[model samples]
Target: MLMKTIFKLLAVALLFASCDDVEPTIYNGNIGQNDTFLSFSRSVYLLPVVQNQTGEVKVVFNSSTVSDVDRVYNIEVGFPEASPANPETFTVPASVTIPAGEYQGSFTIPGVDNGLVDEVVKRFTLTVTNLSDNEYMDNDTTTINIYEVCPLQADFLGTYTIQVASEPLGISAFEAGEVTLVEGDSQYERVFNATVYPGYGGNQQVTLAFACNFLNLGQSIDTNVTCDVEDDTKSLVHAPAELADRSAYDTNDDSYFELTFIEDSQSDCGSPANTVLTFTKVE
Candidate 1:
């Protein structure tokens, strides 16, 4: 009878302890937010289709975290590169969600005139509080990189007209039929290259190099009319009255006369020398 009573008393004590160990109800408690929260995935953006000559960069926002958050809060984007030399721009949205949700807004990037922009994202952490008691809550961070693209240009490409042997060249024997310049399959930047080829020396077999630069054009082209041996014996051909000048032939030298239109003297023609001449232009 005594052992039975002792066992019954121990049982009653254990029942009361178990009943008192039950947890209390959390009736809309402010201390219920005791979990770990973190936000990542920040990126820079280059807005395309922007044709601003001043080299200003426009950025776009992608905030997809707040909607999954448990508390009612507000998130704002800011730049740390703020204050006289390193000031940042941070414009907040008009309102915050009483129950916390994702939000967005836009503002211009100012004071950057150097055409080079390396923008860093400045994020403002959203704080949560009890609707009844405005208490501080936990926070998270994110970032973005904004930049500008420069323009490019290549070189000068075009065409030009050319002329070789343009002004004139003097060949003592042959007549200058034509004066023309040909590019010869190769494309030259300049229309006329007076130094490239020393072309058209009508001497020998007609294959002369273009090594010379200066050109000689005859002012007057005519024929030396020899009076068929009879005029040579009479010596009536080289009279100063018939020709233009006496200097056409230098009696002091035995070389042939190389005369221009303005230099012709009626005294230059003799029955012993008869030859026809022609002329043209080359640039």
Candidate 2:
């Protein structure tokens, strides 16, 4: 009986020793030590309707957590003022998923070419919400603007009849002929380039360049002149300092170009200290 009692006591001591050798499991609510927040890849994006019909909005995690399961996120759309585009204009997904091992996810926003032009610029805002896990934080909301490619107040791309309404140079009244206003080069938009006769009896032809702001009908006509007389090409005039008076006006489906420039000191052409070149769009 004494030996049996000793054996039982030794067994209990071995059980307590085994329990002390094993480490206790500590439960931590956070998967990683660092904090993670969801953010949009870009705050603003231009939706190209011609080249790329769709725009992508990516949801990225600033810092990724050691997540065992896929993280899901919900997006909400809001219109600050009057909505320019309806809900039908965009194809927004209900939710986006960040894969188990991935830190980024994206959804596509499609642009519809409905031939509708909005007088005012339209925008829609997107925000991230309803995160699958409460451990992550939500960052800033993104705004997407949708508008048609309407540049000018009126169609100003065509031929125009350029004439010097008043020239102090005392040169004969010349028929400048039809000066074709072509679209500007790739570098410029809403700008036109043309070679017109600004001299007497169609004698001197000069390169004309002009541009108009699409948002506002503000116009700027270039007064720099390249005169090529008798196969001798030289820059006769340079752009003036003050162009506040120069402007363009569109009336009755006809655009008028009213330009005035001060000639530089290097100019050999006398008189007409302030050159005024006018243009009437040809029908």
Candidate 3:
């Protein structure tokens, strides 16, 4: 009797161990003929190289399976680039077929510049499938290497009167108000107001000329509005007429511009950041 009881106890212990090693094949209503996961493998594509400045990207993944489960096998992938996540989940048709051989799922991805790494090279992949049993699969993977590009600046060289509008112009900027082609004639009907820098600048006169032809792309604007740095006595003449007729100039990229009494500070007459001042039409 003692021997029989020991044998029975041993048998129960072995059965429990086997149960522990085995994955639960059935849940409340999952893993049935309508809920089995298909065993599969797939390939995904990440950007060969990423582009910067925009900081956005898109990718795709293709997956397949060998023995499809019951209902249908939902699919998903993982990406190291975005966030750490669990296996992706999807719902399949109740009578979906794994084609008796293979299953496929292709995903399209979209992203934005998150300031993580601009124009940088990073990598990520897909996490494959999620099982209803909480047990999931991760296999599909891809990589993307990003490269950042800089934007081109603008040129702002000419004679002009500076105006303040909606937003502040980053560099020493100027805006055109009206054009008097010559004396006693005007083009636009805008009101003449106080100059931007009241006391800092000279009093409003009959005509003002701005020579900003030297301001071009890639040039830095002079911060201090001075007649002449060395000496105020050697200050160049201020032209207001041209300043009023300043043309609309902008840089391909967000760049700087200059507005100096003397046209000695501009660089790259045509490139972004530099412009030449030509205050003609001044009376």
lDDT of 3 at 181: 23
Model 3 Cα lDDT, one tens digit per residue, 131-182: 4563333322233332222322422122234433321113222334432222
Which ten residues in a row are the worst by lDDT in model 1? 1-10
lDDT score for candidate 3 against the true structure: 0.27
lDDT of 2 by residue, 1-283 (tens): 0111110001122211121011112233245654454455544433323222222323332224445567777778877686546665566677777677555566667666455423233567777777545344334466665543322445555777767665443431234456665542211122333332233121222323233321221122222232233322332343432435444444224477555555432443432255565667777
- Candidate achieving the largest lDDT: 2
Off by over 4 Å in 1: 1-72, 76-139, 150-283
Off by over 4 Å in 3: 1-44, 48-102, 129-283
Give the Å error, residue 231, model 1.
Answer: 99
TM, every model: 0.20, 0.38, 0.22
On a 0 to 100 scale, what is the lDDT of residue 59 in model 1?
28
lDDT of 1 by residue, 160-181 (tens): 2222222111212233343223
What C-alpha RMSD separates each model from the true structure? 45.0, 29.4, 30.6
User: Residue 199's C-alpha lDDT in candidate 1?
Assistant: 34
- Can you list the residue pairs that collide in candidate 2? none
